[model samples]
Target chain A: MADSTKKKITVLMVGNPNVGKSALFNRMTGANAMVSNYPGTTVDFTSGTLIEGRQEYEIIDVPGTYSLEPRDAAEEVAVRMIRDHPDAVVMIVFDATKIDRGLYIALEVMEQGMLCIVAVNMMDTAHDKKISVDTADLQKVLGVPVVATTATSGEGIRELAEQIRKAQVADLDKIIKRLNGEIPDKKSVGGCGGCGGC
Target chain B: MQKKLLELEFGERGVVREIRTSVHDLNCMGIRVDRELKMVTKQPIKGPVVVLLGEMQIAIGLDLAAQIIVDVIGKDA
Candidate 1:
């Protein structure tokens, strides 16, 4: 069943809202992605093909999510993408200007047992705001590859592609256990946590 | 091609441009559009406002277009 010839890589882009995830998707796939202020515009998954190192890859852009737990239907899809597609490389796109919030999601993604790559998107904006993020420090903390990029202006897009070529397929059974067991019971999340009002 | 994209993204009639302020002061200020610049105002246009593409079907009239342009861009509209 394995072609064994052409290596098809699927890069899943996941992160918090307003980090220019769709913008980076457009730059990678050369597809003009639709952008908006409000979150959840990208509900379903989107895939595009890019030729890299004589191999074709199906780059995936999953919906924006905040945590490992399925906070809602969208997070369920995001977690499902990680569970169902273990072979895909997970690219955690975080806002350089606001790395604290995105970093939280990055930690949750790491818990999913995927070989993750952290890309700090919107460096230009961060720089303009006089905000600077130590990408090296982030990688150390996250235990993954960290890349700085200004996705809007096409900066650091090529490095992202080249890195995708070197992405490794993570094991699956291990991921499944985490999805089911690793998620903390909502009952312990305190009262009025939103979901089910329990 | 720019106009076509503007038409496609904004709508057939939705044409807006970014209007630069004259005083060049204040933390936030509203302005209008510059058809020549091919940009629009999105309110508090100060700071690093991300210029993004809006969905089609949301079309604005010429008067509103001039208002948006002049409101954010400048009186040149």
Candidate 2:
């Protein structure tokens, strides 16, 4: 068996475009930053070192894409980066106002069976629109910790970071099978109230 | 009459009548068929078109806008 203790922990930031992925990255990493192209790809990605408690995490800001499906060059880079680091903690930043679309991508990521956390960004806008989302309800549906946040104001970001540190791999085997059309069960499909997400 | 969203001039009003592609892409911006839209911005030559929908603003690529069919509302005709 390989030594798991030697493995380095990485936190990958991902979300749809304009969902404040970069803002969140800046908040988490502070100053020391490196903006570089992904190895052989022309697409650029930002990375920085973030220390949480006793552990140091290599946080990477991935390019935003609507879905894991590569519709363009930037999307290809994002998908490849996520696939390359299967062990990295995936932080999915989503817009609270556009939860349906965000949830669709969230399901796709979870289908890959990676450790994930759902950060419901733009909470301020959601509040202004009178749209209320219960993170606990979402957590129960996604089988992961869901944190509400307003990246611009830094609201709930501390709780998000703490949850990120405590993130774990979700049990998505059954859901993956269902999404892939290998099963016929629809009970869990509406658990999140038809928002296309939980 | 029905026309592509790309054809709608700035400040032009219309109702999104159809989306030729998957609704998933448009859903992110809260766009759906029958929603009232206003052309807020359209850059010269190949650029994204900004559309105002209620309180939300969505910037859509020209290529994608071509696939979105809208019925002219003629608010500022």
Superposed model 1: Cα runs more than 4 Å off: A1-4, A167-198, B1-77
Residue range A26-86, candidate 1, lDDT tens digits: 8988876687867787888888877776767787888888666666788788889988987
* Residue lDDT tens for model 1, B1-77: 22322222211222344433332111011122332222333333232222222211122333333323321222223
By lDDT, the best candidate is 2
Candidate 2 residue lDDT tens string, B2-65: 8999999878999999999878668655678888989999987898999987756788998899
**Cα distance off (Å), candidate 2, residue B72:** 7.7
Q: What are the chain B TM-scores of all models?
A: 0.21, 0.91
User: Which residue runs does candidate 2 get wrong by more than 4 Å?
Assistant: A1-6, A32-43, A128-131, A165-198, B1-18, B21-49, B53-55, B61-63, B70-77
What's model 1's lDDT at A74? 82
Classify candidate 1 by CAPRI docking class: incorrect
True C-alpha contacts between chains kept, each model in order: 0.00, 0.08
